[model samples]
Target: MDFQESKTKENLARSFAAECQEGARYQFMAKMAQQQGYQYMSMLIRTLAHNEMAHAQQFFNKIVELGGNQTQNIEITAGYPFKSGELLDVLKQEAENEHMSAESIYPKFADIARDEGFEDVANLFDMVSKVERTHERTLKKLHENLSCNCLYKCNDEHAFKCDECGTIIMNKCAPKTCPLCKMGQGYYRIDFSIN
Candidate 1:
């Protein structure tokens, strides 16, 4: 069977396009966060953007492997989200989109790949879906914390570290601004790495 005629090939192309758009969207959100003085938050979003681009690269590699390196203008039509707003709204939109991708879109794509005898493609979709789930959870957690104004809070006395000046303070929540650097609360790292 010709790979070019397979659904998985089209799926790969679609995935690549979608991931590229997602990466760009995340990058824009990160830029907005940075402009609003959310240093640590911007960093986290940028990391997600990079991850999305890496996913795009993986899909592109697969496409190249199947169709050769030359430009193969495989015409494809797919619906994509255009959600943009304030930082909080953007975060929420990303979380919702990631959830949809992980729970609905990718699963169906994976099933199609499997049914079409493209086990490797199915595994790729599954793996990406798992990462998307993680992204959804992480972004949702961050969104909730930010919305509640407790991103830097803890139940017990915990050390809040400043990303700019490396200042550390033990308290239930971070200070309004870093004492050393005079940076705003956003400069305090939230350690979203664990989320």
Candidate 2:
């Protein structure tokens, strides 16, 4: 199938639409985190939002490379308004979203791209699907820890820095939030690594 053909074009446009939706979703989550006093978490989520934007740009660039149409792009529909709830509720929702993307959405897109001979796009889909799966696992772990009330049970010495107020705290785990700035524990960092 040619890149500009209907099936290929629809997939590219839909992929771009999905990327845009994911980007917006992350941004909304980041905003919510920031409002809830999770500064570091907000920052990390914002970084993720930026990454999603980059992915959308890549999809868009590919569509443009194949001479995408504005009308067709506008016609492409994608997005899901996430549910708002308590902390555990939010975590569960995110985990479910990640699972859907990893197990259903991306894999299907990857397969279609492969069949259409768009190896590069297929690779992108596969890579993103793997990342989504990892995210699902991490979210589930967080949910489990919170559910069991063991989020801050540690014997060895541990420390965390508040991303909002820059307060240094030494404890078994991060405080429920920064005592000084009231930033959520999500804003607390135990060990930040750079690659």
Using TM-score, give the best candidate's number.
Answer: 1
Off by over 4 Å in 1: 69-71, 180-182, 191-195
Clashing pairs in 1: none
The candidate that achieves the highest lDDT relative to the unseen native structure: 1
Error of 2 at 153 (Å): 5.1
> Where is model 2 more than 4 Å wrong at Cα?
68-74, 77-82, 145-156, 164-170, 175-186, 192-195
Candidate 1 per-residue lDDT, tens place, 115-191, comes to 98888888999999999999998799879888997888987777788988888887888899889999998889644
TM-score each candidate.
Answer: 0.90, 0.75
- Please state the error at residue 160 of candidate 2 in Å: 2.4
